[model samples]
Target: MGRTNGGGGGSSPSSDSSRKFMEFAERNARLAGRLADLKVGSAELFLQTTEQTRMALCISDPNKPDCPIVYCNQAFVELTGYQRDDIVGQNCRFLQGRGTKPEAVSKLRQAVETEEYTVVDILNYRKDGTAFWNAVHVGPIYHEDGSIAYFFGSQWDITELLAARETIVENERIATELRHRTDNLFAVLAAIVRLSAKDTDDAAELSEKIERRIEALAGAHRMSLTGEGLAEDKSNLRTLVESVLRPYRNSHADRLEIEGGAFDLSRKNITPLGLTLHELATNALKYGALSTVDGKVRVDWKETEQFVEIHWIENLGSASERLDTHPPTQGSGSGSRLINGVVRGTGGSISTDYRPDGLQATIRLPIKNKVSF
Candidate 1:
């Protein structure tokens, strides 16, 4: 005060501060009013905007229908085949039939009592006796004082989804059991191969090998009982490719190498694949590169999102003969029609490229298997 001076700049700064505070207060008041309006009318807003949405919805009084259903949308009515008049004011128990589980009801009760949100899969009936899987979600509504109000719920018909899950579980169970049985079978087969390998004599060795192979044929048969491919198989795509060439493996005395990832396939196709491989092996041993020494075979199978391609390549053999070199006699046996029949029967395509390098069979089968890993 002793140094007091009247300054226009100081007075102007104070006025500007006052103006800014007043403006901020006005904006905050407007925002507060809008938030209050939305908080009070959110339920009505949701009903007006999203009532016709595909997701089934219902509004009910949690405190009180017998367990009252206050509102149900068109989707709910259509899914359950109930008219508004038929469902409104009534307990949802009308939708419960023989399929309803008491445990789910207990959970629902617990949720309502605790004012907690609950999501559950429940069995419900339609207007017809047809039962369907219903996914129900129940949550508590709160009043201004944060006291429990009624309940809000949503129901979705998951009958198809539940059915699909069941099917998958069944398939997985079969796959697991099949894998165990197949593992035992392969153990026996590997032991036999080792036993057959014991004899060093060429002719006897070959004969024992062939005998062991004949025993391996039982693998497919065993798989047929339970329906699965080899347990040794680890890749679904490779299993598919191997199915095409498995019969051919060890069919030739010459080295045949299977190169690729592990795949899993069903027993449905395992038999055919085993049989096909057998046919190819028989042909190779009798007339193909395996008939001679210095001959080797390499099998490489690759899978992509769009296609699965298997390739069979045989190398130059000591008994090398041109692929065009026909047999002395053109006699027709199962040999003449085997590969063509199998491929054509499945409506798949086969292309054979016979070169001086050996026989290269490229099989392109469209990807139709829907596999879940």
Candidate 2:
């Protein structure tokens, strides 16, 4: 969580020639003489209210072996609980605690050594040795000869910001769990609709279909607990296809046929496509050509240069006239409609071909990582 920003100690007016500036310079010279080590300050600025803001301001000597603290504002003193006298000449490491990140410290060391501005988050310790999170902004200063001058650093307490972020993450987790529950509910509704068709259906067949669908719905919900993490696990493409076809593997029935050369596909795309595959298989057995043994079914898929195309071609030998000479339109049947919905939802394209040979449903999906394309 390291981060960086701008601080304003780079320069001063190099061309000041006016009488007022000259008089101010003269006063500054006298002040420097009286206090050689004291920092120069602007009277107007010191009187201003800008110093009391939420930001902490400090200056450091980076070239020093310990990077000693040179100056700190009143706000910095209050935020850190270290008065100017107590902090001056002390190594900035006094602000660091056990929880401070070593990587962040390395980044700061590099930025200061290189005399460049860098932003990072580091855990810091207060005078009481209590730890706090700080957004530290650091930059280097240079002399006229381009030699190291000193390091100027500022810090912002961001413990509250980090806490708020944690809260948001927790809320998001709850929302995701709720969404999965809702999706399963929809799956149940879809399963019942598929079983209740326009034609007369036997109770035994209905029960079997319902049971299969319930298991499929269970599969959808089970992916998280049993399946790999949403974005982490590697997926076997062939194994994925097999998993989707599991519900249609009825021994006594001849409803569907699945054939393909399954390679390992990326998990990101396969899971959604898998669910859509199940919905399609369910629909075919209920209302499509899979309803009768004379109704032959073929599902074949092959990979192309940029995508994978799965062809679900259903043929009705003598019942073509009864159903139609063409493939039924999506949404006309609960199963086709379900397939269409899942296909489109997963960034895939689907089209039904009307032919006397059979009703062909082709779904084309990307096989690469560029989903936006």
Candidate 3:
């Protein structure tokens, strides 16, 4: 026996789906190319297509008073939370508020007056008084008579895009700071180790010396990173030298003497000068004035209009009791190369003469800018 269903039958759902697909295909064939290629061939369908798009689009009459908006898409209404009737006759400037930049507004005004194409990003407000960044593009539409009939304008709410850009910039800044910190870490470690290894053969003695030099470098590194203490004031030219030599002073305090007038150094010059000065004191401790009780070291500087000269001299005994009679052809080890780098890096020249009395080194650097006297 056959059984019958209770509901009455209607057209199959597949038939309805087919009809809708055919309708879409027919409409799509009418607008087969890009909008620019079609050129508003079907004005009503073109306007309807723009209304369906997500981007806010509008049309304004150039011939009308105040160039009022004559048409606006559904997306524009949705984005601004404004009714279609309320927006059709108003100027787009209604979206602007106190937060809008006057420069951007002026540019928009000029573009409209000149009937030229322009794109600008401006701060705008919604109907609910909420702010957003809007990127707007506007261009003139010409009629068959070669006269401007309407202005076509499109806009995008770019608030999220601007926020994303700001986040990327902030991340880049943080990455750069981290890179500098890493570089400073390795530089401090390498400098102290190289300087300490030069003076001794005994492992224990070398270790002790390395530890002390590392401590000094750590102090300088802290100052450099935190911009504290002497490092905060770049105007003090002799601060780096004083810090490097402070540990080498004896109980009598006559072993080191500094005689330089107050002057400022640039930030780029500070680290190089600090490292170079540290290396110099290390050398003095090994063989020069600081090695002997009676020996004394004098560091003096003089400034001219175009140059600054620094003199490092070790006064060791009288001329009759001098240790070395002739200057060495070259300085020893990587210390010499490091000092050379510092001199060359700063666009300066250096010379060393091992006189019968003591070792004399002179560095002449061009005056970049003298912050103080």
What is the model-wide C-alpha lDDT for candidate 3? 0.67
Instruction: Give the Cα lDDT of each candidate.
Output: 0.59, 0.63, 0.67
Return the TM-score for each candidate structure.
Answer: 0.45, 0.46, 0.49
* Candidate 3 residue runs with Cα over 4 Å from true position: 1-117, 121-134, 141-146, 150-167, 173-199, 228-269, 284-330, 341-350, 353-373
Question: For model 3, how does the per-residue alpha-carbon lDDT over 193-265 read when each residue is reduced to its tens digit?
Answer: 7754775678898787667546655655554454443333343567766776777765427778998878765
Candidate 3, run of 10 with poorest lDDT: 1-10
Rank order (by lDDT, best first)? 3, 2, 1
Q: Top TM-score: which candidate number?
A: 3
Flag regions of model 1 displaced more than 4 Å: 1-46, 166-183, 196-213, 216-220, 223-373
User: Which of the two, 1 or 2, has more TM-score?
Assistant: 2
Measured by TM-score, how close is model 1 to the native structure?
A: 0.45
Q: Report the lDDT tens digits of candidate 2 across residue range 61-180.
A: 655546678777777898799888998877677788778889988988776644556899889988988778888898755454344456778889888999999888877875774575
Cα lDDT tens digits, model 1, 1-373, are 0001211111111344345445546765796688687775757766765566988887666545244787888888888998999988876667888878989877876665555668988899988878888999987554433444456788988889988998898789878867855664565455435544443458775675547455545744554454333333323545544454555553642377778776454443444345445545555666666766667777776765654566767675665667565321113333334444444434454567667667777755445533211
